[model samples]
Target chain A: GIQVEQSPPDLILQEGANSTLRCNFSDSVNNLQWFHQNPWGQLINLFYIPSGTKQNGRLSATTVATERYSLLYISSSQTTDSGVYFCAVENIDQAGTALIFGKGTTLSVSS
Target chain B: DTAVSQTPKYLVTQMGNDKSIKCEQNLGHDTMYWYKQDSKKFLKIMFSYNNKELIINETVPNRFSPKSPDKAHLNLHINSLELGDSAVYFCASSQVNPANTGELFFGEGSRLTVL
Candidate 1:
């Protein structure tokens, strides 16, 4: 029951542009996360990276996890970075559970 | 100072109503999470409490019930409420085993509206 897929479901950048957001998982993952739901909804957790890279400022994340996929990088963006961007997974057959989300990636950073 | 604090930020019940949603974590976390954001946002993960026990229970039905009296509280009880139980409910915290390793610290969402 692990299937998280998120890509440019919708995105529109302007203010000091720079972006890349993707997450695709169908299997193997102990845990992985990246969230930012702003615009008043408030989710904000930007990256737990169950595998590799991490930055956090202008934000950055990369979790290759042997190709299961994950990448979220937003360089000079602003306007509070707009909204919605989630990618969560906790597979590996779900032991030590809960976390399976990805149906988001709706940023609109315009300045 | 609000590591994770959830409450009745909004909840409007009706249809055979029975509601309860309250979670708190001052970061002394031992693990506590319950997420459900529908209405297209779709971030789902029902219950998960680590110190007060009850470790994850997805599929979430049984009229939904999750209660953890210690380890910083985890409470969500929803009985007859319907209309798909509306949406938006998030409360999170981390740190427990194999290093739950930072990051999850959300809780500014409650917005339920069953009608």
Candidate 2:
């Protein structure tokens, strides 16, 4: 089983601020995804970057597969961004199977 | 439209009871999974089904059984529920492709409280 570790287990920021969250895996992965669990407990897929970079709205993510790490950035955050961010990975050996998730990073944004 | 949906968004039961949660995905995905999120928010995979066949069972208790009646539905049944089983359970679905495993779409979690 591949190990996924997320940094800054807890975060608090004022609205309109910027922040970055990181995820480090223990092995090469064929599938890497970032998810945001809103206050209502719905897990929303933020990114599916096994490698490279992508951006959507105020969110962006970069994955360095070779380095076994990924970073998620949020610029000018809003109260809606307050929730838990999760990093999930499927190791190469997993071969399209279930993804292993890291302990999430809880984010609180106050306006 | 909701890509994935789970019924009985909240369940509260007593010990020794048996309950079931139903999940359905309309994304036409080939794989579906069940994950448990504990109080500390640690998410762990409990079971995965590929094309309605059991593919991964992560040492989950025998009391926990998952059934996929078809490619679009996977249901979880838990018997003799204990307090430890109290947690939020999520249902997710994804397309399993060699080139890229598509992003998993998850349903609003089902919160189970075993008293």
Candidate 3:
């Protein structure tokens, strides 16, 4: 079984501030995804970067598979972005393709 | 149209009751999954089904059973529910390919509260 750990378990920032969340896994992964759970509890897919880097609007993510870690950046965050960010990975060595999720980083953006 | 949808967006029941949550995906994906998110917001995979066949079954209790009637639908049934069974059950789907494992699309989630 693989392990996924997220850093800065809790975070708070002003509406215009920026932040970065980190995720570290214990094994090589074939699939990695970043998700944002909104305040209403809806899970929104943020990125599916198994490797390399990708950006969507004010959000960007980079995954260094060789290093077994990934970073998610939110620029000029908004109050609507306040919620939980989760990183999930499916180990390359595992038989099942279930994505193991990190505990998540709770973000609170205050206007 | 919603890509993935689960019914009974919210459920409240008493202990020892039986309940079921139904999930359907219109993305034409081959794999579907059920995930449980606890009160603390910690999400974990409970079951995974690929094309109507069971592929992954975590250490979930026997009371929790997942049934996939077809490739596009997966449903979860829980019996003798306990207080610990109270959580947000999410339905997700993805297409698996050799080149890349598909990204998952989660439903709005079904929140179950046991009394």
Candidate 4:
């Protein structure tokens, strides 16, 4: 089984602050995805960047597979962005079947 | 048009009881997965089904079983539930092709409390 670890288990940000969330994997992975568990408990897919950078509005993610790590950027955070951000990876051991999720970075955005 | 839908958004049961959570996907995906999110918000894979066949079953206890009657439905059954079984259950579906990038669409998690 592959191990996925996320950094900064807890985070707090002001309405206009910027932050970066990181995820480090112990082994090579075939896929990586960033997810945001909103206040309503809905798991929203943020990005599917397995090895590159992608920007979606105030959110962006970069995955450096060679280094076995990934980063998620939240620029000028909003109250609505307050939730848990999870980085899930599919490693070679599973043949890209299941996702091994990290503990997640709990982000709290204040007004 | 929810891509993934799960029934019984919340379940409260006593220990030693049995319960089931049903999941259905309309995204035309061949793969469905069951994940459990613990109190500390760490999600772990419990089961994986592809085309109605079980593919991956993590070290999940034998008390938990997953049944996929068709390509669009995967239901989970838990026997002799325990207090430790309390967690949020999430059902997700994704296209099976490797090129699909393993992007999963999850359901509004079902919060289960085993008292």
Q: What is the TM-score of chain B alone in each candidate?
A: 0.33, 0.96, 0.97, 0.96
Better of 1 and 4 by TM-score: 4
| Model 3 segments more than 4 A misplaced | none
The number of clashing residue pairs in model 2 is 0
Residue B114 shift from truth in candidate 1, angstroms = 22
Model 3 CA lDDT for position A48: 96
C-alpha TM-score for every candidate? 0.33, 0.98, 0.98, 0.97
lDDT, residue B89, model 3: 99
Per-residue lDDT of model 2, residues B1-115, tens digit only: 8899999999999999999999999998999999999998888999999888899998899999999999999999999999999999999999985435578999998999999
Least well predicted 10-residue stretch by lDDT in candidate 2 chain A = A90-99
Q: How well is each residue in B42-63 modelled by candidate 3, as lDDT tens digits?
A: 9999999988999899999999
Q: Pick the candidate with the highest DockQ.
A: 2
Q: What is the C-alpha lDDT of each candidate?
A: 0.86, 0.94, 0.95, 0.93
Better TM-score candidate (1, 2): 2
- List all candidate RMSDs to the true structure: 14.1, 1.0, 1.0, 1.1
Instruction: Say what the interface RMSD of candidate 2 is.
Output: 0.8
Q: Model 3, range A1-111, lDDT digits (tens) per residue?
A: 899999999999999999999999999998999999999999999999999999999999999999999999999999999999999999998734788999999999999
Name the runs in model 2 displaced over 4 angstroms: none
DockQ of each: 0.32, 0.91, 0.81, 0.89
lDDT, candidate 2, A1-111, per-residue tens: 689999999999999999999999999998899999999888999999999999999999999999999999999999999999999999898777788999989999998
Give me the chain B TM-score of candidate 3: 0.97
True lDDT of residue A62, candidate 1: 90
True contacts kept of 4: 0.95
